[model samples]
Target chain A: MPQPVIAAVGSSPVGRTDFPGRDLFSLALEEAFEGLPDPAELADAVYVGNQSEQYEHQIMHGTLLAEWAGLRNVPAERVEGCAAAGALALRHAAKDVRNGEHEGVLACGVEKMTAGGTGGATDALSAAFDRAIEQRSGVTAPSQYALLAQRYLHETDATEEDLAEIAVKNHRNAAKNPRAQFSDEIDTDTVLESPPVAPPLKLYDCAPVGDGAAVALVTTAAVADELGVPWVTVAGTGTAANNIAVAERNMTEIEGAAVAAESAYEEAGLEPEDVDVAEVHDAFTVSEALLSEAAGFAPTGYGYQSYLPPESREAGWTDVSLSPSGGLKARGHPIGATGILQAIEAYEQLTGVAGDRAVPGAETALLLNEGGVADAVTVAHVLTAGTEVAR
Target chain B: MSGEDRLDVDSPLTLPGFFSALADGDLLAGVCADCGEVLLPPRPACYGCGSRNVDVEPQPKTGEIYSYTAVHTPPPALEDDAPYTIAVVELDSGGRLTGRVDANYDAVGIGDPVELGTRALTDEERSLALEHELEWPLHVFEPV
Candidate 1:
């Protein structure tokens, strides 16, 4: 089987933006195809990851994005798993390449979350939950995650301050990232004192609703060699779905994510200890902690120490650095576009183009993107250093 | 809830049927015959062991708070209902579900006993519901 790799990647500036989804996708494509041929010249198919049709009141994202990229008559479609849609698109492209079905595929994602404002985003996102109970109970995204945070804090040695520190650390990391939404570093007090969107979860603890788009060209070694562009191997991919209802699943364990990550690790022939950096979905502060444990990077109940350095974290914790792109917390969570954004961050880190926030000598990385509340569905990808053809 | 059952709104395995039962003041759960996992608002398949041999059983109305939070910011439809307390309650029968709480955020704590109650959908909830969902009763938890 051919090894799939991400040859090129780009993302629009994250956070509340003036562009529509398609326009944001253009900006991303511009950066991704910067010194290369047009997408139509190389891409044999296109996949777009999109969360909802309610935000921009538009559908047919695959057709629209493909047309915008100047490609036509390609196998194009929109993949949806709420927030995990981007990685779903990437995963589809990777499979197409690995199976020798397509030599070059464009995997892209976009979300104009700011178009309809916060209320619109909330109503749209609620559709990700089980409508029978959780949605009927008026659970917003924050409240759903707060249900987990409340339990996590109660059951663990971690305090609310510890969760706040996760936000702070991400913001500090974002300060060094040009594409981040909130680049200014914040103190723990900022997170602790922010207005409560949900109890035990202040407003700052929640990832801001934003607009973004990202595009990645997934192809085999031949395509990367032909393009002569810096690229990284897409070593493995895994995805899993748990019960959509938060109450029906293991609220704090995020077991679905664990299963997905393990599948990726197995395929990549690696263990968690081998990963140098990761972009775990920190959609909420509690999520980073929960996913840390779930992904095998942190010991049970000690994931909250993610804000600390590797040496400072509890025993059994791996040396893997989490969310060098500042994660969804500071990098911005633009719904569908987030998974592609994560892949872009990993691409930059492994290629040594991550600038100030780069994890030095980073060779392998994990990208975990989730949809719904705490892993209703999850997509994990393992990336190892691949060819970086001379420019 | 039999594996051979053909589902309809009246079937206990379906949400409409489950809500209809809740409207009649009887909480029901699907007890997995294989793993003994209790699925709240009974379904045909068991998530614990992937068993389809689920038995529809009437569950106790009382349970304790497994976790709780207050929605200080709510969806636009329920903006007036901001700061409403909600919880994930683990019942004595081993089934867990979420519902609104009839108390303040500080008034409840984990492990606090609460009794499940049913109320006709309010205008706000009705506004958010579809034509088929209009008749589904909303579950609430009251301090016991």
Candidate 2:
């Protein structure tokens, strides 16, 4: 058995970038390979996470990205689970390293969501839902989430104002992150009054549709040591799939996410309390609240208090910070690239290099990325700070 | 769809078959013989018990709103139909499914009684459907 670690990470500027998908991947690759050999020199395999071909009317992302990275023949493929594609790629690469199948694998994600504009993104994303009912019902992403938000509010003590605060809090965190898309603090009123994309979900409630790319190097311990860069160990990985239709599942609990996170926690031989920081999918404001509870960091219904400082939360809450990278809410979600973005944040946070928003003494981090309307699919990974960094 | 009916187009376990039934005005649900989980738009296996022993049964059209919302922004094909209400209705047969509610945002709430109705796809929706889906009707919920 081998220990897999993330030796390097890089991401393209998130938001409506003027770059295409492959170009975004190239920029990310350049940043990640700086002061090091080209990716072709070390990557034994490559996995690119991309959401749809409709955006650019292009597919075969594996061949395109691998060629762009100057890698010729090594095994390459694209992984798709919508927004969770990035983590799915990382999980595959990490497993390849851990199994001694590959010494170094490139885990990458890219999405040029702005290629077709908001309406284009909307129609493309609608393909993720069940075609028979959900898609035919004219449900946009926000409306699907709004259904959950509506149910969440009705079942919990939380209100629309509480959900609005989640957006505000993430925006405040994003203000400290250079990689974030919306780098300005916002008031709850801004979130409350923003044009309603769906009732119970205003414009601020949803993650922006953006274009971006991210790349991570998953390698064996020796490779990381040789690279002389601070690294983080990939301790555990877990994935779960739920019903495609949101109506079929427990909307309030996000049970699939809970199961997936628990599986990862079990593999790491750790509990929820052991996590110092987490980058859960805040694709929507309600998602942040739901994922907090799913990760076991907060009591049921008390999860909406994530906007408050940990100490100010309910008695059952742990002192864990959520979405310090500002999260999808403010950091901008490039769909496929989002999962890898989570890994990048964890890598930085645990290695003691996360700028202003760093959680002090953070040693362990959790990354949860999801696809589909709710938890149609979810990937959870646990990362621990590695030792003997020559940096 | 456990035995000989697995590939049968007439079986309620398949998508085309399910919609074909809906086109004829009868909603079908798959009840897991083991866990008794009701699967709407009936499928082959039960997610609850992972049982392939599913029994297709006619689902009641009437249900209460388990959850609801209005889509202020919709896909381009339905641009003219913005602000339409939608909901996850828990049917009388224990199966739940989402569909458009014929009402305004403020007109609906959780637990509102509604009944399912079937109709031909509008010209806009039909334009978005595939050759096969052109024949499959659309389903919506009306206040009961």
Candidate 3:
């Protein structure tokens, strides 16, 4: 079977801004479709990810975004698993193309979190937890992650400086990304001194709440070949779920991410050593440390040491560059927009369009996305240049 | 309760009203009738067997801290009560619950055995409003 290829990608400039009650999903859909090479073109199917209907106060957002994007006649479906919504949408689009159900598909992710204010938004996101056991007990997102960070610190030799290094590196990378929410170059001291949202996890250590959207145009290799457009083939896709309660799993490890990454690597017929660039979810500083180990980029409980010194970017150990797109920590996590944005970053790096932040001579890229305190779900995918799927 | 005491009441409730009835002196969770899986926080369906046939029954409140964290800055509503410890207590019945740690900052650690204690009522309006009650009751966990 022919693999699905990403043909073109688009996104709204991610940052704090005013939309004046404009439906966020609608704005993102319009932004994605406008100024494309072919405006009137329609997709065979569409997939979207949304978390809280009560927060957005809009139900059936899949149809809303589809209609707003002029894809009113296509089949559209919505998938939700907290932050993984966007990645799950892409997985659906990939499945449709892989199954020959659609010649081409559109996967879009958008979230309007600023609508309800920060406290309300936090409450809504917290609903992803076990309502009866966790959230009902008042364990918010930061607190849940803080527990993981605490355990990680206790088990490993990693320190607050190690996590600050990740924030520094990603922030430097975001400085070159025009759409990132925090593009300023920050040092370790700044991150260390930032107000503590959760102990050992400072304000700078967490991804900000922002409103934005991202979209990707995917098609079968045959369709891309006929269109004469550049593309990246989806070589592998994997997903896994853990216990909804964070306390149920090992706080020092992200077992689900490890499972997902191994599956993706196997499906792609590639090893961790073969990846040239990666964009792992860094929803929080500790998340990057845990995910890097789980994804096999570093030894278990030692990923905090993987932070390549800024000077080392020119000569980093293990040539595979990571998070050249600033990642969630610096790139502004607009929730639903995150997964698609990761794909966009991967596409840019693979195509050498990432400007100064581009990983030199990049060809293969991996993306890891997780949702809800590392408890709900995780998805990973490997992408290779051209029409040839990795094998 | 004094004004300060009311302010201290902004913590989260350890269990739902139904389960609160259990912690109030009874212990209860929905047990899967089909697979016999015990569900905490009491769900209507059995996650183990995907069966809706379940029975709410009393269970042991004894558990251990699977993991924990000492929160220095509480949520905005609980700001007055900054610097508290919260932990995930793994029940002997194979369930997990999160609540305030009964240990001081230097005393708590992961994997420590814990048992359920009485809930502390808070007066914070938002916290009270969330429980839809006049007071917010926070579950206390002690080292077993």
Best DockQ among the predictions, by candidate number: 1
Q: Distance (Å) between predicted and true CA of A5, model 3?
A: 1.1
Those runs of model 3 whose alpha carbons end farther than 4 Å from true positions after fitting are A20-40, A309-319, A387-391, B1-21, B24-66, B71-80, B90-96, B102-107, B111-114, B120-138
DockQ of 1: 0.90
Reference-based TM-score of each model: 0.98, 0.98, 0.85
Off by over 4 Å in 1: A388-391, B1-5
lDDT of each: 0.92, 0.91, 0.76
Estimate the Cα RMSD of every predicted model relative to the unseen true structure: 1.6, 1.4, 7.1
Query: Native contacts recovered, in order, as a fraction for each?
Result: 0.92, 0.89, 0.40
Q: Each model's DockQ? A: 0.90, 0.88, 0.29
lDDT of 1 by residue, A1-391 (tens): 8899999998898988889999999999999999999898889899999999999899999999999999988899999999999999999999999999998999999999998888999999999988889999999999999999999999999999999999999999988999999989999898999999998999889999999999999988787888888889999899999999898898879899999999999999999999999999999999999999999999999999999999999999999899988899999999999999999999999888898898988999999999999889999999998964221
Q: Label model 2 with its docking quality class.
A: high
* Residue A49 error, candidate 1, Å: 0.9
